[model samples]
Target: MQLGDISVNFVELVREACHKLNVDPMPVLNEYGVTPETLASPKARISISRFMRIGQALISTANQPALGLFMGQALRISHMGLSGYAAMTSPNLERAIRLWIHYESLSSVNKRGSSRFYLTEESGVAQFYSISPYNEFNYFVVDCLLSGWSALAHWITGQERLLKEVEIEFEAPPYAQHYQQAFNCPVKFGRSRNALIFRKEALLLPSIYANPATHSEIVSICNRELTTLVGATSLTERVKQIITPMLQGREVGLTETAKQLGLSEWTLQRRLKKEGVQFQQVLDETRKQIAETYLKATDLTIGEIAYLLGFSSPAAFHRAFKRWFGVNPKPFKDQHASGRTDENTATGENT
Candidate 1:
């Protein structure tokens, strides 16, 4: 399955790791268009492509190829957003792990039919989906996910060396020795699956933080979000998904989009029409949503945002912004920023 966008929450893990190494992450983050404001939004997502690029750069800068393993050690429940909270309050380790797997999309998205991670409850094994043909670009993804889950399991259940063993799909790399430090358990490579094998009895370990009332409420919220996420498989939604990643530095037209969707141009048009939306409309709407995000959640200049959004020129972007919001970009951004500040202040006072 093709990779999709992941939550900015995961990016924070990288940033925290950089801090531990005394490496400034901003240079790499800015090079990839990740801004402070973007990280501030719990709901914001970074494309998987950009996330990988950031990881590679950070690993190089720190001269630590096993950066993902160390980064996983830094994982905390707070880093997971709502899903973490739900898992923390679960009745036991098994339920907590299941909640994490079930609500995985709250933190990251895989392609429509793909599962990013799974748990074999009966065996107490948790598996991360393989994105093989592993190289410097992607090996860290597997390392971070499996190790991160193990770290969280240990933290919640108050168990040290919680995993019985780790099974990696790929053969050991040059840094194989470091796996011992990351997992503190038997680490086997060239296995059929990438998994963290838990001691069966450990699956019943009670969470130190489990709270029945809180768990119930958070699960309800997660269920609603899951419903909204999975229900968005409409053709228009699919078109937007195809359009988002393609907007990095170039305009994506209907022909390219239909090609990506594996549908002929004419057929794509007919289907979108059947959904009561036009191709250009969907494209513009997608651009508008992304533009709003860049404007509100990044310090990027108008020209920079324009280039990222695939506008022909800054003037073109300004005109489009005016058309979308009925105002020019600068004042509109200021208005929203001020509103956010006020909202934050009010929230603080209430708390």
Candidate 2:
């Protein structure tokens, strides 16, 4: 149910990956039931299920060089940056996933921090995972995890494909054929976890271009920037992360949130200031998201929604929502409610 943060251009990543595969990825993407257009919107998210189907398919069919080399090429790293370089300096393929997860945002402003790789063991198989925080663009996470790692493994051993199995956590859908193609291995769904399985020998593959110097440098840089990328994990990210969550609730306030995070009022304020945000401003932004989420998704009365947001009065909520989105709650809700349900928005997707 998660992809990296909500901002990454997942469709672009898919397109780039497809480009690397030397086939129009759109056809495959469409086969898995996603349109290139739907994912084009910055705030838009694909349900996790759809994302997995596409990912499974790609991993089954795609070659290793396509996953990294072409994906790197698709992102235009030659002039702008290095997808391969980032993947190369890591200690292992898992570290390489983190590099893509960390520096991914550098290449795409929409890239967020939710996509991550982890390991799991079930039924005696080594499962490497890519997880998402919510349901949006879940396929992107699945695709990247399967294909990206497969690509990295290939790079290490100079092989074509690396995964023994792709263990998907979600239920299998209609795209089994395509799924088989992308992963090029047994694909199972509704499993305990989402992962790629490799034989024990896979881990022993030496990185084709391991470098201690570059590895150290990238790790240092990744550490500093990753803290910021989390945007809600550390003091910096905490402010960003809590902004939307706190706003949606009725009891938002500086002192309350400071207490919740186990910090004194002054300390929280100082930290947020360093991150270029103030308590009141962050509070307003939070309220705006809360206001929008409630307005669009619920039938609660204006008075109730306002009260739920810690607004002293409905009028204040209305005024604030207007400033945040140019239109007030009622109209915003009305417009969204009237629109087709083809695209369901993420309640707390943030930059």
Candidate 3:
């Protein structure tokens, strides 16, 4: 799946980790505009830059170069929400990891790359690797991710996971001793990759929470959420996310959308072009989709719906709706209002 922005809950976890170290997270939270409301809601997102600023603040405040390592050790299964539940309820550690990896994006924004587990039978080792983007938070992101994986495994099986060795891509930090304490294993820095090496046999351990029936049910929910999140990962979906709310208030344009996404208008255009979509095309489609939903489901007037959709006037909305559906709005509403049960008339075009 394509990587994109992260969930605000991960930022909340970072703040929780900071609090564990007796660090006050407010100053940085205020500076970056991450409000209590943002942290309170798991579905909210913090842009990549804002997330890095939080990491920077935690490190600066705690004066711990190995803050990420300490933070990783602080992870709890409950912090991951549905994904955590799905993982723990899996039949075995290996299946649990698969569940975790599939829905991990529900926990964090994964812009650099998605995570994966690799099993090497020859060495009887399973490797967990996180692709780190080339940013200041690269090490911090990977540290928390890998360590959190180890932490989750330990929590699920109620057993200690003595990693074979922990390999890090970055040079050893000044407080490197913390790595050994965090991972409870030898740590190697300046390695070719960042991965946690462990015995493959660990994958066979039965989870105390495992229930095949429950797992199957929760898996369906996870898959649905995965589809939604994956859609939000695309450039077009990102734009629509921004445009949807903006439309309720005022006209949303490319410049404003690009600004919210932290990209120059042209850069956003180029990327969308690569995906074979135009910015206006995305905006119009979004408006049309919402317009149709409002027309069908709500008793709101045509003028009210037009205004809510950011159209300057009902006439303009009429022209656009006709262009999209090849019919006027009044007749469409009248069909539904008159108790006409024909699917074609209710759909506004098929008739």
All models: lDDT?
Answer: 0.79, 0.54, 0.71
Clashing residue pairs in candidate 1 (N, C-alpha, C atoms within 3 angstroms): none
What digit string (tens of lDDT, one per residue) describes model 1 on residues 1-351? 123668887888999988998899999887776778778864777666567768988999999998898789899998888889999999999899888887887777643222333446545787776554467877898889888998999999998857789999899988999899889999999997789898878888999999999999999999999989768679898888777666755888989999988999999999999999999999898788767765664345777778766788999999999999999989878877654311111111111
Model 1 alpha-carbon miss at residue 18, Å: 1.0
- Best first by lDDT, ranked: 1, 3, 2
The numbered model that scores best in lDDT is 1
Return the TM-score for each candidate structure: 0.67, 0.50, 0.63
Q: After superposition, how far is residue 338 of candidate 3 from its true place, in Å?
A: 62
Report how far off residue 93 is in candidate 3 (Å). Answer: 0.9
Candidate 3 ranges with C-alpha deviation above 4 Å: 1-3, 122-136, 231-351
* lDDT digits (tens) for residues 1-351 of candidate 3: 112356666777788888888988878777666778667754666554446557866788888767677667888777777888899899888888777876866765432334667678632233444332223445677778778888988888887864677888777766677777788888888777777776677778889889989989988998898897566568887777677656753688999999988999999999999999999999898888767755653356788778767888889899999998899998877767654221111111111
Worst-scoring 10-residue span by lDDT in model 3: 342-351
Question: lDDT for model 1, on a 0 to 1 scale?
Answer: 0.79
**RMSD of every prediction:** 10.9, 9.9, 16.9
lDDT of 2: 0.54
